[model samples]
Target: MTTGAIIFMIIAMVTVWGGLAAAIVNLVRHPEASEAEPSPPVEL
Candidate 1:
């Protein structure tokens, strides 16, 4: 309702959605290798 509240809401929305967008872009640019083998377990 208030102007300050609206501004804060927008900032929060951008923070959340912006982080998601950045993560997606990063994943797309550096995708995981599906055919990669898992590392062998180390002996204790």
Candidate 2:
């Protein structure tokens, strides 16, 4: 493989892995907010 292709592949792999790590960290650190009560609908 060309040097440029190898570098691009490495960057892509790191980005994906970094994103997954950040997501997992956030999920573990914070309580799920999906169960919170919704505000009453505003009448236009």
Best by lDDT: 1
* lDDT of candidate 2 at residue 11, scale 0 to 100: 100
Q: For candidate 1, lDDT tens digit of each residue in 10-38?
A: 99999999999999999999999977978
Q: All candidates' lDDT scores?
A: 0.97, 0.94
User: What range of 10 consecutive residues in model 2 has the weakest lDDT sum?
Assistant: 31-40
Q: Write the per-residue lDDT of candidate 2 for residues 6-43, one digit (tens) a residue.
A: 99999999999999999999999995887697878999
Which one wins on TM-score?
1
| CA-RMSD of model 2 | 3.7
For each candidate in turn, the TM-score is 0.74, 0.70
Q: What's the C-alpha lDDT at position 37 in model 1?
A: 73
Residue pairs whose backbone atoms clash in candidate 1: none
Flag regions of model 1 displaced more than 4 Å.
35-44
TM-score for predicted model 1 compared with the true structure: 0.74
